[model samples]
Target: MRRPSTSILFIYGLAITLLAFIYRDPYSLLLISIPNAVAGIYLGYRRAKLIVVLLLLSIWGTFLNAYFLANHGQVVAVLGPLVIREGAVRATAQIGLRLLAIAGAALIFIGGAEPEQIIRDLEAELRLPKTITFSLAYALRLIPLLRRDYSEIMFCRRQRGYRRIAYLPGDIKTLLLPLLSIAYQRAIWAGITVELRGFRKRRPRYRRPRIGLVEALLLSWLALQVVLPIMAGWTM
Candidate 1:
């Protein structure tokens, strides 16, 4: 299967994130989470197994949330005479749907697109500024680097005889400034390397990636995001 463009993924991510916060109804929560789960499984380009596991966890969490809400009697439906089951049985199904949709969208976007490809697509296809594209690329790399650095810093602290070993949150508080400083230094060196290699002064270029069915479908999805709310009178 062909990969989705960056703009499509961005739109999908933004849309679900938007919906997650927009509606108060449990059904809306389901709507948002389902896509997140699917996207997590299908759209991820890195650590496929890990992504799938995380997606499943998200799906599970949504189900649990719905189940919790149902127990409170907040989620209820009346069918012609007989009422539907009061709690988890109903809420689980509702929330499950949303989680599936969310993961699916995430999988579609992130699963196939590589970091460089995504940045390029964003810059060229989406017409984002080159600076922004570069910044995003840098930021994306930093996510993993930050994690690694945090580990190293903690190790160094332990090796140097610091007795207090903190958990993730505590480690974060102690390590953030130093980690950030290291990251900044690395970024500056990377920037200098790019400049030395003449990347900064390179002439602009573009690719004519075929606007095929995938692109068409993605455009439709993007358009739907704008049109659906207007037609349905739903703010999301």
Candidate 2:
């Protein structure tokens, strides 16, 4: 089925990612991440792939760190320069699970949600400050414009044989002034657009969405993820 509410999803995702750090046991971290991973897969397969890739990288990094840098406790294996320790394996699970939980939590917010929609929802429902709402709304719009600008600038740089950073963002180091000039012009236009709209202190009110049974069940699941782990003394 579809997501019930993005606002609830945002809060739930943030809560899990933040609270994940409180648990010490790897199994507890794994437990908390499962529901998020499951929900993400069900709701958005495409976006879920990104999270899966990130989790894979984290797992790889954790094991690499364990194999190379982790040098405590009893030796489990030896392979020339590589020394595998029992503690290193434990550390790998701890760190990898933490990353897994964090990545899984991300799915709840970004997996199936649009940036503009999220901003609008928060602005209408949460009543965020005008400055914050306006900035976020405009920032999202600005990204594609900036990318186009960047492509044009990079093209010009290549014509000039500017090999400073080789297609990386650092290539902008010398091009900063021109980019700033473009940005300044864009800001001026954005301000004019806002003023024309008569954006003011009075914010239009939005009716709150009624939560259905599915959302209520999701809320309960979110609570249980933390509560049961804490009850089991799996906290750091």
* Root-mean-square deviation of every model: 8.8, 6.7
Least accurate stretch of 10 residues (summed lDDT) in model 1? 45-54
Error of 1 at 227 (Å): 6.2
Off by over 4 Å in 2: 66-68, 112-116, 128-209
Candidate No. with top lDDT: 2
- lDDT for residue 15 in candidate 2, whole number 0-100: 83
As a whole number from 0 to 100, the lDDT of residue 171 in candidate 1 is 49
lDDT of each: 0.60, 0.69
- Model 2 lDDT per residue over 55-100, tens place: 6656766787776777589988899977788878888877777776
| Off by more than 4 A, model 1 | 14-29, 45-110, 154-171, 206-209, 217-236
Q: What TM-score would candidate 1 get against the native?
A: 0.55
Question: Can you give the TM-score per candidate against the true fold?
Answer: 0.55, 0.63
lDDT of 1 by residue, 77-165 (tens): 56586344557555665555555555555555556556777667776666767777777667666656765776698788788765444
**Residue 165, model 2, lDDT:** 40
